[model samples]
Target: MDTASRTAIVTGGSRGIGRAVAVRLAAAGQDVAVVYSSNAKEADAAVGEIEAAGARGIALQADVADEDTIAGAFDTVEQRLGPIDVVVNAAGIMALQPIRELDLAQLDRQLRTNVRGTFVTAKEAARRIRPGGAFVAFSTSVTRLHLPAYGAYAATKGAVEALIPILAKEMGDRDVTVNAVAPGPTATELFFEGKSQQVIDRIAGLSPMNRLGTPEDVAELVAFLAGPGRWINGQIVFANGGAA
Candidate 1:
């Protein structure tokens, strides 16, 4: 799709990679709706960045995991910015605990916000996005890395990856594309918090690039998928610096 013709809704766009993706889409001349569950200040800041890029920007708050909230959020976006030509499902949660110690509550939370959330968001996108639009879902390299305590989290992302192909086929008649981007260890606030310097260094060393991925790095890949990368559909593009 032409950048100028794009109108996108990015879930969890208030901060980190989601915010960066929103900014990048705006830079590419796509009007953006930045959706957030909370943190009005951050969402407003993201809107400012998008507007600075000379694209229409709006902030809408909703829980992507909730069907009603997701519907309401998309309605607001469509009302404010024309039909969405791009939908980026970047909203997710990560909680780590060994399988033996993993509680039902944590598992439910991850499934609701990660797997089910992606499903709800993409289902809505499938129904609402313009015929030639694109849908991008977020996955994680932890799935490939097979970390000890990340089984549950990885399962959620794995489910997302599994759904992309089916979604692509379902949306094929409309010429829409579906894909997922699996990022490695990114330097988002979520990754940095409670980590010691040594731990961070070790995590960085795990990647062949010898550094953690940045939000902008992933955003660049997302921009490609949203625009020129349309031909690449139903695939998991790992933006992990060759880690796993």
Candidate 2:
């Protein structure tokens, strides 16, 4: 792919890692559809940033876990900007709860958003993304660290890890690559939500880099995989600064 004017659908594109990916893709000359669950304002803001980067951008609403909504979101993007060349499934939620204290409600929500959401988003992308396209799914380094309070959250990302290779094989002849990016503790709101400064510092120290990741750190790899890294399929690339 030459990377010029390619269209992409980035789920959860309103903030954090998703927003960073959107900005990177746009700066790379790709039109982006910034999909969000409920925050139209944030989505619009992301699109604004995308347009400023010299590519067309649109805001769309879709619960990533819902098949119909995802399908519609893809359709809208293709209709408005043209065929989608990349699909980035970055919409997910994480809550810290050990196995002993895990709440069924939280477990169900995480399963729906992280596991089912990726499956549905990948399914739609498989059906619609143009030839020589790519799909970048998100995972986490915690899946390897076996963090205690991340049982349910890790389980959801584990399911994503299992799908990457299978989806790549299925898309073999189609020329679309499938892969997952597992990030370590990042400085995103999602990572800082409930943690104190001491806890954050402790987690950051676990990585050899002795620092937390930023959205741009993860986005760099995403831009590579979605752009020129077609040979890197069916693998989980850890963008965690060697944290795990």
Candidate 3:
């Protein structure tokens, strides 16, 4: 995969799996634009790492759910790095609450940030991505596993997975690919926060690997989808370590 002259935009690139994807793309010789919602410091750190990997890197701030913000972020990337060739929509939030206890506000937040954000980001990519480009969206294994508290979060990811096939069809004529990456229990801050050691162990044990997944593990798959795995489109690739 000769990505040396290509450019990629990774939303939520300031931390976790998003950060890992951004860095891995950079290491693969793609100029990277790291988009963050609020954390400039973390975004800058990601940019630094991308640059150290011998690729051009820039950090842009934008709320992924807002249409105007997403547009502005894409504009900045185009202006700074040229036409975007790859997009990884990794900006999302997880609000774990039973359906009965889920509030309208929390439900709206999850839908807006996760589902709407993925929609808006993919729309922009569909509009601007060059031929042979790819768009990757994030889903979660919880959508299939159906845990008790993850109703809302899983709903949002389910929406993402549903959109993949349609988006792939829409973008196919342009020689662009659309896909989703569903990760299982990973050792991200979002996954480990507020959990006891026993809880973490139990979660890890859910996977046949008997261990929590690493960001790099997920990122490697994302990198492959963005580069060599372009032929695999409109599908949800689960990097779950055989969990579920």
Alpha-carbon RMSD, candidate 3:
0.9
Measured with C-alpha atoms, the lDDT of residue 2 in candidate 3 is 88
Candidate 2 worst ten-residue window by lDDT = 235-244
RMSD (Å) of each candidate, 1 decimal: 1.0, 0.8, 0.9
Tens-digit lDDT string for candidate 3 (1-244) = 6888999999999999999999999999999999998999999999999999999999999989889989999999999999999999999988777789888798899899999999999889999999998999999999888878889899889999999999999999998989899999989999987779998898899898899999999999999999988789999999999886
Best candidate according to lDDT:
2
Order candidates by TM-score, high to low: 2, 3, 1
Candidate 2's displacement at residue 95, Å, is 0.9
lDDT scores in order:
0.92, 0.94, 0.93
Off by over 4 Å in 3: none
The full ranking of all candidates by lDDT, starting with the best, is 2, 3, 1
- For each candidate in turn, the TM-score is 0.97, 0.98, 0.98
Off by over 4 Å in 2: none
> Which residue pairs clash in candidate 3?
none
Clash statistics: count for each candidate: 0, 0, 0
